[model samples]
Each structure stands twice: as C-alpha cells, then as structure tokens.
Target: MIFSLPVQQEPKKYAPVRTLMLYLTEECNLRCTYCFVKKEPKYMSRETALRTLDWVLQRNVSGGEYKVLVNFFGGEPFLAVDLMQEVVDYGRLERPNLYKTFKFSATTNGTLANERVERVVREGQLALMVSMDGGAQANRLRPMVSGRESYSLVRKNLPRLAEWARLCTARVTFTPDNLELLKNVRDVLNVAPVGVALCPVVEADWAGHEQALEDAYAELGEWFAAEVRAGRRPPLEVTWELLRDYQQRLICKRRPQKACPLGESLMAVDSQGNVLPCHRFLHRPQQRLGTVEASELPDERWLYAHLKRAEIPDCETCVARTVCGGGCRAVALDGGYGLNEVHPYHCLLMQAHMRLVARLYAELRHDLNFWSGLAQVPTDTLNQELYQLGS
Candidate 1:
C-alpha cells in the first residue's frame, strides 16, 4: 500500500516534539573499551542545568505536548547526583505552574548507588537504565579507571538499585567477541527484574561472527516465544519496540517515521551545553545542533535530508522498513559514511531481529484473545507490566 502525503504539507504526527537529554557530566569511574563518550573533567553546572531546563520548558509553554521527558545522561550520571536532584526538584516546582507534565530519568553505569544517589532517585521517582554487559563480559569490557573489575560492585548494588528507581532497565551492548545473548540475558535478568534492551555494537566489525550472531539471536527469539507462550512476561524491551512499529505500519496502517528521533522529538545536551542530536554524536563537533544559551534555532538540515525512508534508495523497498526505519544515524556516521548512509551490518542485524519479531508475533497471532489484549496494551503500561513481572 502506498502511504501518500500532500505535496507541501508535513503531517502533524511527524512534527518535531519534546524530549530533552541532559548530559550531566563527561566524567566516568569506568572506561569501557568501546564507549563513544569522550571522557573529560567537564560537568554540567547547576547554573547551566537550570538554564537548559528553562530553555526546554519555554519551548513547551505554548505547545500541545503533554509530557516532556528530561533524561539525565553522562559518562556516569551518578557522578553528578547533586545536579540531577537539583534539576528534578526545580522541574517539579516549575513545570506544574506552566501546566506541562515533566518526567525525569537517568542512564548510569550502576556502580555508584550510594546513599545520596539512592535518596535522590527514590524521592525524585527517577527511571533508571544501567549499562551492564552481563557478568564476566562486563568486567572484561567495562573496568574502573584503576583497571579493577567492576562486575562485583555493580552486582552487589543490584538489590538497592532495583528499589531506588521508579523503574529500572538493563541496557546490554554486545559486540562480535561477546555474542552470548542467552547467557547475557539470563545473567542480567536473574540479578534484577529490570527490563532489558539487547543492543548490538553496530560499529564493531563482525567479519567472522555474522552467522554466530544470527544464531544467538534466533536462540533468544525461541526462548522469548516460549516464555510468552507459558504466560510469563519476559522483559525483552527490544521486542516491544519492534512489535509497536510493526503494528503501527502493517496492522494500524500508519506511515513510517524516522526510527531514531534524534533531531526531532528527541535531542541531547552535552556537559558543555552544546546541543546534539543524541549523546552518540558528542565527539563529532560538526554535528552540534545548537547550544542551550544560544539565541539561534538548532540546525536540523542533516536530519531533514534523511527523515523519510523514501529518501534512501536502499530502504525504499526493504521488507523491514516499517520497523527498522532507515537504521541508526550514529552508526552510519561512526562507520565513516555520509549522514544518510546506513552501515551494511546494521541492516543485517535489523533484518535478523525482524525475523525474531515475526516468530514471536506468529506464536500469539492465531489466538484472537491473546493478540487483541496485547495489541491494545499502551507503551507505558506494557513497560510497567514487564517491570512487575521481572521484579
């Protein structure tokens, strides 16, 4: 089916919306081997943090978006816990007055669940996402500046980490060397019931491990389907995301939008206040969209050129276009491709994942009651349900 649009009008549904990511600091305790964040002593001061918030809130003052998300990001966000607490407190006191609903979340290394960090997270009701690549794999890939194993420290903090946040998610980044999906998934889920996102390091070379990677994902898909078939909610967040996109384009008959809403409904603010499409582009100075203190608007021309799938020749007729949404921009840029170019392996990985999604959907599609019930589940509720089930 052809999804048509008017010659000159952009749909309201496709307009840029609100989601501000704040990079609290560029300092991290651990130095991961493949980490993209440029570690430095820079931190977002209280003055700069508040300035960024005001700029975001001011943009939403006249807008119709009901909920604006403010994400706390960093080399390790917990390193700047005081700044997070201050911003959350300020947002609480100020946002309601403007009649806008603002929510707070953070992405951390899970090593600094200290007393102050716990208090801020609990009281502020912050949603936390921890970057852990499973047990020993984590120690190998991500180690402290002193070169000590961080696996034990993060593992010991899991119980308290689970309690402090309103919700928690385990973000696992797998590379060619570490393709043990089942083991990694099981290891992380066993420790904490947090939702899980299995992300491949797309920029990493997969020369000899392509088949192995595919096999691992296939095994994971089988396990996921079995868990659901047994009436248990598995905390596979990637499945939910792919399923949502598939339902929208194929089932609901809606047109596809850019998968990564970097310069659109989403954006990131670095520690030095240079606004970027997302944190992944922090090292590329040319990708800087604008700064919080600047009066001029953000430069979104790079985003606009490739915002639609039709703009890319390779994606125009691809089977996974609905869910893949032209792939990751950061990966493309990191692979030394043009802004609109997608890495070949990125496409391969997405195609493999789409197959996994298809298998899981087939398992439930025949059961009208089960399928309908799941199709109607909202994103937030689905996440909450997964959290409850995992916990």
Candidate 2:
C-alpha cells in the first residue's frame, strides 16, 4: 500500500543541513538480535560513494555553511574500507577548500579495528563510536556469525582502536535481560576514560518491565553523580544531552523550537544513495525522500511532518515535552505507531531520566568541589540556572 504524503503545513525556519551520514554497506560480521537493518552482502561502489560526497559538498556550499560533517555508517563501515578511503582522498584533492571543511566519524561493531581502518581514522580525525553492550552476558545478544560471544574480541581491540581515533565512545543498547547491568556499566564495558552512552532496545516486549527500567535509570543517575564526585566526566551522551537541554530551559525561560536537528539540518543516505530521514530509517523504502542525484530535497513538510513536537498529541501537555522531543521517530514508526506518537515504555523511561538529570544537576550546583574538573557544563552557569529553576 502506498502511504499518502503528509499534507503541507506552515513552514517553520530551522538550521540548514550541515551533517550527512552515508551507509557504506549493509554487511555485518556480528548478528545482533535487535539490529534494525536487514543485513546483506551489498557494498557501496566508489562511484556512488563519491557522488554522495559531492552532493553533500554542494549542499553545504549552497546552504552557506563552510563546515560539514560526513559520517561513514553501515552494517560495518570497516567492511567497505576501500570505498571510505577513496571518498576521503577525493575530498582532500578535488575540493581542497571544502576538504578541510569536512569532519568525519563512524559507528562500527568494534571487531574489525585493524591497522587499515585505524590509518583512515587517524588521517581523517574521525570520532568513532563502538557498539558494546555491557558485560559478556549482556553482550550475548550480539554474537559473531559462528554463534560465539564477541565481548572478549571487542574489549581487546577497544584500547588500540581508541589510540588512533580522535575520540572513541561506546554505544550500549539495554534490553530487559541486561537492565541490571546499568549499575555496573563502566566495569562491564571497560572504557571508563572513553565514556559510554545508552539506548533502549527498540520494539522490545516491554510488558512487566517498566519498573525495572525505571530502577535501572535511577541507578544510572547515581552512577553519574558518583562520576562527578570523582572528577571524571564520562560523556554519557543521552543523559548529557538531556541535562544540557533542561538547563537551557531554566536559563532561557522558554522551550526550544525543535527537538533535534534530524530532518531540518541533518539527513542520512543509504548505500544505494537513497536519502532517508535518518540512519535508523534505512531499508524503509516508504520513507525515502529522493536520491543523491536529485537536485531538490523532498518538501520540508513531508520530511518533517512527524518530527515536530507540536504534532504529537501527548506532547501538547507533557511537562518534559521540550526536552524529550517525543523520543525517537524510528522507534515510534517500528512499533506500528505514528511518528508523532511515542512508545509508552519510552515515555516512562524519559520521564524518569529527566527527573534524575534535574536532581543530579541540583546536587552538583550545591557543591562546587564536585564541579572541579568536569567539563560537561560550566559551574557558574549551572549555579545560576539552578537558582532560576528554584525560583
């Protein structure tokens, strides 16, 4: 069935697109249980990769932005190392001015952190995010093709991979089975100085597990507080983003205009050069806007129809609507719900998470000693925001 395109609404001005993610291939070495992409042996050719890069450069130039971010994404981007290298080399030579304007990054499964991939990362100064679910047991959901656990392999290579990359961050997806590990995340992942981020298992059977998820978030909050006390600032991505948004709300005394920059200022292109709303929407043909060769993007109305917080019914009255931004659109779409509607489980989780972050911010502001070296936020600004929030 062909889904009808969304009706056009009054256009709202937003930032121009400055980030583009390219899915280099759809092949993966590990069989992750919750992976959304349907794995295949397909790899992007040099021609397609270069065309995508040129498209991005043109967009940046037309949008009046000198700098742009080009993300190498995939089932495993390392599988297409040659294609990636070609793109990087081409950018440096063909568009020397725009070459220095490009910032590179990738999300990999961490098993293939070999010398070749390391050289590309170092030369391009890429920020690499490695997928690693907590301890061995928690990582059982992610196994090699031979049905063997991959935790040991990833752990062994993480430090070495961390060395060449500008920054290495761990991305964890927590399912019900591994919810308990949230408390021991640092020890389990073994990347304390590098830092870790959290994401919930999308479309999981969240029945009878709401309380467990809440408790786990609470534990994580305590963990974050401890990290602050110890003068170590781990980049807990989700939490850090939320904390900053919440603080911004208190300081500005107003809600943000948009939740995230997804459709407005960011987009993802699949290996076949089909432009998608985001990387998570890959393989979803219905959501395809156009191809990289197309001169014009899909109308903003169609691209951001479901992304606006005001479009979500529940968000109208939700207290954290400004900060939560109705959660992930991909998760909502996968759950057979409208992109405007958030999953119930995710709603509960975010509510709990926002409260935890607010409480932690309050605690940190009260004690300057806890704020000695942490760089997530400024102490003076946080103190003023806390004062405003209290008033």
Candidate 3:
C-alpha cells in the first residue's frame, strides 16, 4: 500500500535516452510575462525541420535505446502544426526500417487548437500540454501580443485539446505573484479532464517568499493526499514526480544525477536550426551547441561543469542535493545566480516537497481501504509500480 517495491539485490537501473525538442517557430500569439523566448518572426523551414529530424534519427545517441522522444516546442507550437504534421509523417515513414519509434509531444499556449492541430494530435498520438495559469493570473501574466486577455480563448480550447489527446495536461507556471497554487489547479481541472503540472516560476527572484511558496506547496500536498485517500488519482504533476523519484531512489539505492539534463541527455534545436542545451537557452547565442548540419553533437563538458550537483561546492553539502539535483540550470542563471547554483528558495521548496511526499506515502501505506480503492483509480504509473512491487 505504501507503493514501493521491496529493495532488490540486483536493482533495475532506469536510464532514459535522449529527448529532442524541435523549436518549431519563434512566433507566438500570447506574450507571457515570464516567457524566456525572444519573440521574433523566425520560423523553421520545412527543409530545416525534416533535416534536423533526419540528423537525430540517424544517430544512436549514447547507443542502447531504439526509441527517441521528439517534442514540439515553441513560442507556441500549434502555430506551426502544419510543419509538425510534416515532421511526424516523415519520422513515421522513415523510422520503420531504421528500427526506431518516434514518440511525439508538444507544449502550446492553448489558444490555437484548430482541426489541423487536432488531426496531427490524433494521428501521431502526440501528448499535448497547454500552458495556462488559470483565472485572472492567466490574463494578467499571459496577455495576448495585442494586450487583450487570453484566458477566455485558452479556457474555451481546453475541452477540444483534451478530446484530441488523452494525455493532455495544463502546465501552470506558478510565480510568487500568483501564490494560490491549489486554486489555480482546481480551476484548470474544472475546465478539462487534463492533468495539471504546476511548474514553479524559478526565473523570478523568490528570496523573501520562501515560506509563502513552501506553505502553498504544503497546502497542495494536503489536498493531494486527501484525493488519494478518497480513491481519486489527483492529476498533480509535481507531487507525482516527487513520488516517482523517491520510488526510484528506494528501488535502485542510487542517488539521482542532475535534475535538469539539458546539455547532457536532452537537447533542443531552434527555428534557425542551431542546437542548444534546451528551449530555455533559445535566443542566447553563447549557449548554442552547434547546428543540425554538423554530424557530431558539440561536447557538453562545459555544461556538466556546472550542471552536476556533486561538482557544485555548495550543493555537495546541501541536504537536498540528491533530490534537487542542483535545481534547474536555466532557472538558477536566469534568477541572477551562478551556473550550477540553486536559488535559496528552491532549496527550501525541495526539502518541503520531499517531506510532504514522504508523509503521504507513509499515511497511505497502512490504509487498507485506500489500497483497495486504488483498484478503480486511474494513475500515470501507480498500477505499473504496484504490480512491480507485488512481484
């Protein structure tokens, strides 16, 4: 009932392969306040997109895996759904003989879900995540380029988005200004059957708001635990991710590596075909790894230099090091901290989240009724892990 597998003598190692995010276009409908993308008129040419897909497909990145995850990223990806369709069609056609499968996903602002985008989502089985901040926060922080509220458009589109992709989720970027995390999550869940992923706005300076942020997450944790006890699987991503990581750590008896594997196992190609560590480093020319034209990926030693928590002097001694994994490199640097450093607030948040999850796991472990109720609950990985734990 605790939902953890008994420690195995020969623990199963979980090693994920590389993820390729195609920055489809630099153009977006809404100009989000915390957005990092330097909006421009640039769009990835069809040739460039297909060629970049070809480059990634041809290489066996670090070998081992036969599947590659191709994600459509953007200023807003749905604007370029036509190009997305082309790339997915090309990958499907060419990948069969190459012994590879392409798993597709996209992160959009949710304002542009038309029939074209729906077709690609259905045909390609693309998992879609709509960026929505819920209620007034959505309009205030993510207003359209024309300065109009975007909340109505995005809210209206959520049902259609959920219908198109079973794995549709709303990604809420939580900032200190909008501290009501649980309320926003509830608002989003009310609109659609999609999951809610509360991504903290780490780019903003959160020095004085540590306690507020921690309390917000704790409130969310309490509600999430209640949802579990009541036999409903809460569609909350942050808590789910924490449980998954904790479960892995228990099963494997291994500490996690860096939290953000940007330049390591994950890489992003912009509309201009220039490769970078991730979408967060989009317009910064200095962060460019190389172009798609190059046969080999640029060396990532410089990234690992600051990306690894073990190498960071402060993180080495920090209690949350293994769990936080040096936090997000982009977030650290964007918040005016050094590379390989985590914001002080982030450090506290991680500790609080882990404690919250540990308590939830302990509480549910002894609840026989809760364990039986799990039979009818739909979860992302609960059933799979439960089966593995039982075996």
Candidate 4:
C-alpha cells in the first residue's frame, strides 16, 4: 500500500503569545539524574508570583488574545502551592473578565500531592503532569531527596491524582540506561489513561545506541499496532504524535512552521522574575530575551530569525521535517549544534518512529472497516472532510 503526500500550503503568520510558564521555585523533592536545572533553595515570592500573573494577564487583555495557558513549573510546583493558589484566586477575583481566559497546568514528581492539591485540581482549576519513567527499575534515576526509590511513592498517588485532576499526563524520560524499560511504558499508561510522553535524554552521548533505540521503538510500534487492532485505545505519545501528523497531512494538507512554542507563542519566567524563551533555557543567561519588568512582549522578529524551522538548512530537504518540526531547539543547542540542526540521535529516533508509524498506518488503511472504526468521527463525515481538504 502506498500513501500519497498532500500538497504543502504556504506558512501561516506566527500566532500571538498566549502561553506563560511560571517556574514557581527551584526547590524539589526528587533528585532526578538527568535534571537540566541545577536545583537551588530559591523559591518564588508571593509578590513576584502576583507580578508575573499580572504581566501575563495584561498582555492577553491588551493584545486581544482569546485564551492564556498558565503553566506552573518548578523543581516541583507543589512545593509552592500557597503561591499557586493565591495567583489563581487573584485571577478569579481581580481579573474577572480574564478569569475564564486563564487555564492552569503543572508538572510535578507527584511526591507532595495531597488533599489541598486534589481540591484545586478537582475544581477544574489545574491540570497536573506527573513524572514517572516506566516501572520501578527504570525510575531509579529519579530518586527522592534522601536517595531512596520514588516509584512506589509516585505510584501510590496515581489513583488519587487521576481522580482529582480534570486532566492528567505522565512523562517518561528514556535515557540510555532505561532503554530496556520502553516495554514497561504500558505500566505507566495503565495508571493514567491520558497518556505518557516519551522523551529522550538530552545532552548525553547517544552515538552507539542508535540500533538499540531503533529496536526499542520498533517493539513499541508493534505493541501500539496490536492495541489499535484489538480496538483498544492505548495512550502512547509517540504513536499519537505520528497519527496527528498523518491526519494533518492527509486531511488538512497543512504543516506547522515551528517545532515548539518557545520564543513564538510561549515564554517562561523564573523565580526572580527573569524571562527566558522557554523553561529549557532557564539557566542559560544568553538566551534571556528580557525580564518581565523590562518588556511585556517578546522580540518576535529576533525569535523568528533565530528559531524558525525554515531557517534550518537541513530541515528544508528532509522528508520528515514537517512532522518532527526539526526536533527540539534546546536539545540542539545543548548538543553544541545550531538551532537549525537536530541532534543526530534525535534524527535517528525520529526516522525510526516515522517508518514504524507509516507501516502501521499502511496496514490499517488496507482494512476499510478497521480504519473507519479507529477514530470517533463517522467514516462518511471523515471522507467528506478529506475530500473538501483536497479540493
């Protein structure tokens, strides 16, 4: 079976800044080995938290932005729950018009989740993302402050966390050491139906592990294909991303111009009120566009010139460029490569993933009934939509 590629449309104008990532504190309960940020004792003060919220709200209101996604980030955001609640309450009371415009999210190690945190999440005020790398053995890299295994502690809270939050996601970081644990990803998926995002460990030497990584992804791809054939929807980030790209290409005939929202529609603010392009650039001083006190809007022209996918020479000719969005810019920068050049390991992993997903899609398309049942949308309606798109 052969799949025809859709004609690419002209790139659209850059979207306005709508995402604000507030790194609540540098304090954390876990000592993850691959942690990018150098953990510190500094925490965001209430005054600074309020100022950050006000700055984001002012931008949305003045820029005529429809919605603002406020992501609470940290070494662990739950450590500063008081500050988070104050900001949420202020948004509700002081900025009533923008109250509904605000959407809250957080990423945590799931160590400090309690009744208070549950209440906030249950109230539909926040969506929490828990970091759990596969099973116990794989999670050894993310130990507690006392250097104890944290998998059980995190696993114990999954049920309660799932019940409390309106939305919850699990993030799994696949390092060279944990490559074998890719098969155990289902263990995390079972805990949270929302899905598990598989991220490769950056800034490490992945030179000889190309074949191993490819084999692991192939196995994972086979598992995903089997689950889909069984009429069960399994939450796997890799599979979902490929499926989304397939739909966008075949149905919408359009591709994204940028890989990430950083420096474009997203910005991250540190504890001291210093603004950077994204959370990944927290410690990198040179990447700091400006501080919240100095500038309300990011320098889009500079950001576009520096971070746009089109600026990447290699991506211009790569077949998978549109789908991979030229990979992560932060990872490229960390690997001592230009923002336009993707890390070799990432490039290999993406190529393997695309091959596997393409094979699975081809097999599914051969069976008309199975393909029709895969998505919630009716077959006739989907066909009509695709027809309109290709017109």
Q: How does model 2 score by TM-score? A: 0.86
Give me the runs in candidate 1 sitting further than 4 Å from their true place.
1-17, 95-97, 252-255, 298-312, 367-378, 381-391
* CA lDDT, every model vs. true structure: 0.72, 0.69, 0.70, 0.68
Q: What is the TM-score of each candidate against the true structure?
A: 0.87, 0.86, 0.84, 0.85
RMSD of 4: 9.4
Q: lDDT tens string, model 2, 1-391?
A: 1111123423233344566778899999989888887889888878888887676655554356655667788888999987888877766554433432666777888898777898898888877777777778856789898998898888887887778777677777777888866777777446535656676775778788878877887888887788777767655756766677776778776765544456755688888888887777886788887888775676546875656562356666765765765566777788888866677767766676777777888888665544443344434321211111100
Error of 4 at 164 (Å): 0.6
lDDT of 3 by residue, 92-146 (tens): 7743335566778887888988789889999998877788786865578889999
> How well is each residue in 316-388 modelled by candidate 4, as lDDT tens digits?
5655655776667777888788877777766766676677767777777665444544453323321111111
Q: lDDT winner between 2 and 4, please give it.
A: 2
lDDT of 4: 0.68
lDDT of 3 at 275: 80
Clashing pairs in 3: none
Give per-residue lDDT, candidate 1, residue 218.
Answer: 82
How do the residues 125-226 of candidate 1 rate in per-residue lDDT, one tens digit apiece?
A: 888877777787668789899999998888878768878888888878788877885445877878888778777877788877768877888888777766
Ranking by lDDT: 1, 3, 2, 4
Clashing pairs in 1: none
